[model samples]
Target: MIAVNGRDTEWREGLTIRIIMQENKYTSPRIVIKVNGHVVRQEQWESYAVQDGDDVLVLHLIAGG
Candidate 1:
């Protein structure tokens, strides 16, 4: 199991950042993903693999005037 935005989510092998986002229906264009306290590069989302018991934080960036 893994903690995604404070909620417990099922963990599986070969799970990448992209897969996690897809599974959680996270489609925000300006999304920031952090795993185990480490920031994951946007370009690496498709290939960044998260492990079991990992804490994943997904935040949507907002811009205001």
Candidate 2:
């Protein structure tokens, strides 16, 4: 199992940052993702693997004018 935004989720064999984002419906382009407290770059999302029991945090930045 993996923890995403403090919620438990089933761990998958081929789980990646991109997959997690899609699963959680994080469609915002201005967002940051962290795995185990480490930031995952946008370009590395596809290659960044999410392991079992990992803690993932997705935060979107909102702008106000």
Return the TM-score for each candidate structure: 0.92, 0.93
Q: What's each prediction's clash count?
A: 0, 0
Worst 10 residues of 1 by lDDT: 20-29
Residues 1-65, candidate 1, lDDT per residue (tens digit)? 99999999999999999999888898887998889889998899998888999999998989986
* lDDT digits (tens) for residues 1-65 of candidate 2: 99989999999899999998888888888989999999998999998989999999888899998
Off by over 4 Å in 1: none
TM-score of 2: 0.93
Q: Clash pairs of candidate 1?
A: none
Candidate lDDT values, in order: 0.91, 0.91
Total clashes, candidate 2?
0
lDDT for model 2:
0.91
